[model samples]
Target: MVMITASGKGTSSTKGTNSTKVASSTSGTNSTKKASGTWSPPEFDESLPREVTVMEGEPAELPCVVFKLKGRAVSWIRQRDLHVISANGLTFTSDERFKVTLDNATSSFTLGVAEALRNDSGVYECQVNTRPKLSRPVSLKVLVPAARIAGATELFIRRGSTLVITCTAQLHPTAPSKVEWVHNSSVVSISGGRGGVSVHTERGGPQLSSTLSLAKVEMRDAGNYTCRPHSLTPASVTVFIVDDEVPAAMHHDSGVGRGGGCPLPALFYSALAALTCPALCPALCPALTCPVPPYPAPS
Candidate 1:
């Protein structure tokens, strides 16, 4: 036979044919447990940069700083395409250009894009999956540099003719605020004299556009002229003017001068021909290298 007994204060039990006492008892008080330490979710840095500008072909960085992380995760996403770029300090994008670096000391999860392109200009988001899901939007702006002259690379005009050329630059509306005209690599200004050069800005286009004009072309203007603008790659235009001596040579006057042949102007034309021979000048070439001017003598 087996016997058992119970009460509010305690309990006991026994089992046996001879009443063997396999006893058990219970106490009135319940077991106690210690409370755990307080924990908080991660938070983002408030003073993060809202907009970042990086030049094209360079690397861009978007920072994601968190406080009191408590084992939370950080992630970066491309807002334009909604593609997950990085998660938990690991890169999720298959692109080799995308990477994530985590700094344990500063709790910074910065996303890096290498060799940035013009198409990469857009908004990106840095997110922390915390209790409230903290996030900060960072706008990435990519800048591309470009400049070009919109006309024939070289222009030929007769004396007393009006010469006009235009220069246009991309990625800037009024870039190169100052335009300068250079001849033979020497700075030439718009002198207040007859047949002078002048540069004027035209406001008809979105990008920056400037027009350089010579009111009346002359023999002295028959050299390589450079169109240089501030913060832009300079372009050159070679202006060739026809002289009366050039035509006389076509009429069996190819010999020496005054003996029924061309004059000094003919030598100038010949020099130009030799300098611009098909074997010398490439099809798509820039201005010729100017001979350095002689050093000025001390006064």
Candidate 2:
């Protein structure tokens, strides 16, 4: 006798002259096989908030998170008109107020502008380094408080002359912002809080103004000075100061002040001026006058 069994049903037997056979019925059970090579990574959620906003001199935070970030790195970048303001984990901005911060799961990059200015408003980008690069860009609009300079920004002081810089900034809501005179890279004088130095604000967005005075100016005070408004994204304006005497000779010649007669001096000065000036000569020194030769015109 022989018996046969199927996966689902019971066994059955069949008998012949010298042999018996049994077979099982295949009733409800079903079997299916799946291939092994059809696996893929999870899809990324690219529709998160990509833009942020903050007031001038205020601290702003940008958040970036990824759902499928297994082997990727996060990077933050600030995209100005034609420049990358910030990149990688470091800051590349000429402005000292911008900085980057990273978290365990999310990336929170913070930009602190001591006192926000009109120029501080722009687009900031957040990027993820993965097989397929992912990026999110946010637009930041900085609201500058009502502020203006009341006195002379450049002062011609002798070795021991007195110098004073007056800065006035006004903001809506009339919260008193900090005002200080920054000499070189360090704080030389501060006013406003307690007795250090400062000005008061009034109601209804009144214009606030203050003066940073240097009773006796010295050679050491011959660098760049900035009036910073201490607030959440503080705004600052730089004022350049030099000794009473003119520069002996510029590192490079800029033709700007070398007017009248000496082509060599003019050329030299122009070159130096071009290098020093933030913008090139074609824009700053449009009307350049050349020196005439000693010989008179033939009559």
Candidate 3:
């Protein structure tokens, strides 16, 4: 025969015919329940941003917030190559630019990369040591803005004529604040000694354009013209001024032309030949009828 008794302390006693046994199985179970009920696993704060953007050559920081961390360790991993960058606020990568910082008060683990480059743009993961692990993904973007002229890399303009040059800058994922024009290594300004010089800028979404105009441009105004954007590569175009000796038709071309086309004055002179029709009319205008010249009287 066996008899069992239970007490408030979660202890149990069993009495047998030949022996008495006391077991505290329920006490162990209660202790386990209490411990589990008092502790919670780490979890990420979903309110924080998951995407970050920064300009090339600038610093980039990605933050991960985790609460109820207890004693769990945090790590940052680069998803591009599954490379471990840092763990428990200690850097593991060979790159000196990568660093990890933790704020105990806020429970934020931040991964910082100095002097970010275009190649550094990718998704990174912050992990907390837990069963199956708790992770949050963050994306980094590195932008590189560049500038280009509206026309060709070289321009030709007639002296004493209005010269206009338009420059366009592409600032992706960012808006351009301003564009500066440099003429022959000197910054161009409307208030400068060169009168009638004007610069007009307009913004259209991600592209910013600035037009430079010089009224009655002189030969001295010919040189390299560059459009420079803030912290970005500048674009340049060579400007050549034509003298009065060069016919207007010789220098006038679509902004992209290098003044290599056949001169209009030559075409005008050819048209005059068609009127005379001295056997050259057929070559100038195939549809024209040339009058036959009377053979010189047998002399």
Best by lDDT: 3
Runs with alpha carbons beyond 4 Å of true place in candidate 3: 1-41, 148-195, 200-210, 215-225, 236-299
lDDT (Cα, tens digit) per residue for candidate 2, span 87-169 = 54677677776666645455344444455566767776667665566667767776666445554333334455555666666
Q: What TM-score, computed on C-alpha atoms, does each candidate reach?
A: 0.44, 0.34, 0.54
lDDT over C-alpha atoms for residue 171 of model 1: 35
The lDDT-based order of candidates, best leading, equals: 3, 1, 2
lDDT of each: 0.65, 0.49, 0.74
Best candidate (score: TM-score)? 3
Overall local distance difference test of candidate 1: 0.65
The model with the greater lDDT, 2 or 3, is 3
Residues 1-299, candidate 1: write the lDDT tens digits.
13323442233322332244222122212221122343556668878887888767778888778888877778888898889888867898778998888998998888888978889889888888866677788988988765577665555566777778787664344443666767786776677455367778654443666787886677777788776766667887666665432333222323224453334333344454445553221122222221112233334
Worst 10 residues of 3 by lDDT: 290-299
Tens digits of lDDT, candidate 3, 150-257: 655656666789989888776644544688999997999999998999999988776778899999988789889998877678999877665534433333333212
